[model samples]
Target: MKIIKNILFLVVLLSTLQGFSQEILTKKEALEIALENNFGVKIAKNNLEVAKNNKSIYNTGFLPTASISSGANYSNNNQTIDRQDGTSTSIDGAITQSYNASLNVNYTIFDGLGRKYNYQQLKETYNLTELEAKETIENTYLQLFTNYFQIAKLTKNKENLNEALSISKKRLLRAKYQYEYGQSTKLELLNAEVDVNNDSITLINANQLLSNAKRGLNLVLGIEKEVNYTVETNVDFTNILNFDELHQKMITNNTTLKQNEKNIAISEFNIKVNKSNYLPSLGLSTSYGWNKSQNPATSFLAASSSNGLNAGLSLSWSLFDGGSTKTNIANSKIALENQQILLEQQKITIDNTLKNTWENYQSQLFIINAQNKNVITTQNNFDRSKERFKLGQITSIEFRQAQINLINSKTALNNAKFDAKLTELQLLQLSGDILNVEF
Candidate 1:
């Protein structure tokens, strides 16, 4: 009795643990966790930050640059001198030291608008980086959402299987009782036991599949180990959207298309920047320094020991350079044209994708409606079959057939619902409105 009591306590404890583990996680929470913890999104965000830093460096070109220098030097000299008496004499000079320090400053007065254009280009590049990050995030979110729904659907499937297994167990027990009372043959009892074992095997397989699905969800959510969580099975798809409206939204809001547009703008700016290279560049530079001679005899002591300042404006024009600059300008123009062609292609692709997904969504909705009706019909038939069997008007085989039909119908209905919901999600994603949809 004590051993039995312990077994009962263990079963209760396990049941309690499982109940606690089945806490439902909403879609919003899952997405938030993925965004916060996903490694790929973190890497993309870091890349964008690097691009922003690069832009800042380029922007510093507008600020004046200054520098300071200090140095020490020593020198010695040997020479021959002619005296007044017409005799040559040799003289050795001692070492001398000097120290000097200076500061220099340069400010750009003009550079043929090169700096402005380059800054603009860098700004555009920064924006492109941000767009790339957004694209990465959106793609990651889509994957997460798909996996979340799949796990939810699988969990529901397992529940159905478990319910069917319980029903099989009860039928097995009834068959055994009938056999004991001589109301049924041994064959019927054996068949019922076989069905129960088969159901148990199916349940085991379903449990394994559920575990795998949970692991996949955990991977997407950036969790290290397995976690027990439930997904909300209710996804409302009552809002019907027009294909034309979806296409329009995709054209306006698609990140990839917008990124390509930015690329075209960048290419145009590149051409301008390359063309600016042909014009003259003008700049102002100034420097102040103290100069000292290690040999006092060779230095002009009056000015050498003093500081001097100089400032001047200079202009440079590149007349020719092996046609490289011109070639680059032409290349930029070609790239811009290519981007234009790509933009058109992308628009067509998006339009086609939206149409395909919208049609698929409609088809799945129809399947779901049909499956729902079939479920009702199958359930009614199963009820009537059970009644007929109990009244001895039908065979046990017929009753089992009805049960199988009902199970199949239920399974099909569940699958159809899942497919319909997935299709809806795809449509919303294609329309660039998945993030805006309320759960």
Candidate 2:
């Protein structure tokens, strides 16, 4: 009775674990999960939030700063006064206490529109961060597409190995029957057995590879434990690259290039901000203060209280800073030029990538086409050889060769298909179409 209950408990536990552990997802679903949970995406999102916060009016130094403070102090002292006539008066144990509180406000009235430029720069920074987040999402989708399709390829390979193993088993069975009835030699039967064993080993290795592929996909999804999951058998390869469109869009919409452009804008804004130092800055400051003093030694200073408000308009300009302002403006202009140069350089690099990826994508398509014919021919040969061997018209060695050939051909076709799919994804990624991955 106890054993039965224990078995039931174990079964229930496993059932619950399996239910909780497995997370089946389609490509779209996986992408959605990765966008929400990926560390890169989350970090970029946080940086964007920071940029947004910095673009606020208070952060851009457009609002007045106000503060209040209070203080109290007490002191005990002895004092003496002497006159030129040589008579002196002394006082002992004179104690005094004072208290004061103040409220102050400072606002910049004008600074050559530096605050406006700063605000605009911060807004641009926020937009750049937004693009950065989008880029991260796009890159993440590319990675997911890769890992997802790799599993699909491995799964196909596993199926091929399984079918090969089944054929080997059938051959082994036939060989055993022939040997038992004295219709085949012991050597042929032994060879058949070896083929079955070899096939089994290959199948096992293929299964291990499939398992590893699943584990990698799980890791990409940020899942801690392995789970039962399957991906779409078909990979997307619908869109082909049009170089003219890509080149135009590359300069206009490429996130990295746009980020570079933003950098240049910031540098231009910085020049304006620094030029503001050349002009006198005007500010208004106001304070309301209260003070009271208690003094024992003098009547005028004893128990006096006063309260008043003071306001002032202040002007400050750096007359000279050892030519640092000129140097800063020059550097800002240089930096802007540097960013522009980098944007052009990026275009050159992207041109190379597009051309090469387009070629590779085309090459893989040709390979798939070539391998399709090979697969058909190999399958025909394998079928004919199997029949001939069963009728004792061909040796087991000939049949085995045909079997291996067919397997290789099928495997090559699947590889070519997968390679083409990946290259297609790469093309999409380079053109920033991965951002629109859906359906």
Candidate 3:
């Protein structure tokens, strides 16, 4: 019994420790973890590695290649040969065995500059893959930050709703007391009860929304369902960005722009590579081998039983490919021109995006300020109405109107703040500066 109890205790202790070991993530930490651990990012990084390896393969063309090969054969002869004695000799060999081994080397002394152009093209391709991975990371970070801020905003909104609900409950209690003392009508108490119930429903909905938003954020972070996270709500938005500076940064640092530039370079290299096909290619190959046979008369086997070395240079020219090479070169040039056009379009699009986001951010900032003032004004009106209700100077309907107005104002203010923050984040993202921002 003692042993069983001890084992059970140890099991419970290990379970508790495992439960406690789950990560409690903050917004920054969660974003960092997602960047490092997300499946999408991992796959993108692997693709980039593949591209790099392909570049290495292209680079190997500059180096000499050597390989060793060996083989064995067995045969039964069924023929006759004339010997030096001018007599027919029967070559009745029974199970003759032969073996061969060789080391072959090949080197491209010249190849119409094809290898050089191919290597350059592959390097550009590898760089483009890296840029694509960076673009993926930027997109992921934007999504993570958006969700993070949304959760924080929802939390604040829920807190405000709870406060409003508490106020409603207090008002209900006061109305009930007044009705019992014959100082307030039954209708007044009924209205207060209705307000409390409504606030309670709203609070419940807010709680549900907060829960769903948290789950969504966790999903984005690739965390388990049981994990919990808290967002840092105190984000700074005071750093004013100049439009010109943002545009310059986007042009200089945006991964998409870099990728497009690499595409253009790759297109140019493709044209060169195709043009090189019109020229002749030169190469050298050499081989040395040894062979052995059990029947010396049937195989070329001297006392040394070896084959001599052989080396040669080869040349290959397309000469004429029915205009195929010319067509390829034309297609490559057209592609390069298209890429230039695409680059221009991309620049225009980025500029428009930046301008629109900046304008929206400015508009939201003003709305937030105005909503803040409105909240204060509505709060003051509610306070005055409350005092008047207590002194019997205002009716319950008038007091309730003031309370509803205050709630509406607070909700509007919260929404405006959330929108302002969201727009600011968008601007930062469009400018390619979101990752550099320290939350």
List residue ranges in candidate 1 displaced over 4 A.
1-17, 57-60, 76-93, 238-240, 293-304
Task: Give the poorly placed runs of model 3, Cα more than 4 Å off.
Answer: 1-25, 57-60, 78-95, 227-229, 296-304
* Model 2 Cα lDDT, one tens digit per residue, 1-439: 3563576467558956865775656787877777777777788889988988888887988899999999999988787868789987777877889999999999999987889888988998888888888888777777877888888898788778878877877787778778889998999889988998998899889778878887877767766645466566775567664777866755667777777888888888988988877888899999999999898763346698889999999988889989998998899889889988988898888878878988888889899989999999999999899889878898889999999999999999999998898888777777777676464
TM per prediction: 0.90, 0.88, 0.88
Clashing pairs in 1: none
The digit string of per-residue lDDT tens for model 3 on 261-303 reads 9999999999999988888988899999888767646444533
Q: Give the TM-score of candidate 3.
A: 0.88
Which consecutive 10 residues in model 3 have the weakest lDDT in total?
295-304
lDDT of 1 at 194: 86
Q: Clashes in model 2: which pairs?
A: none
Per-prediction tally of clashes: 0, 0, 0
Error of 1 at 100 (Å): 1.8
Candidate 2 overall lDDT versus native: 0.82
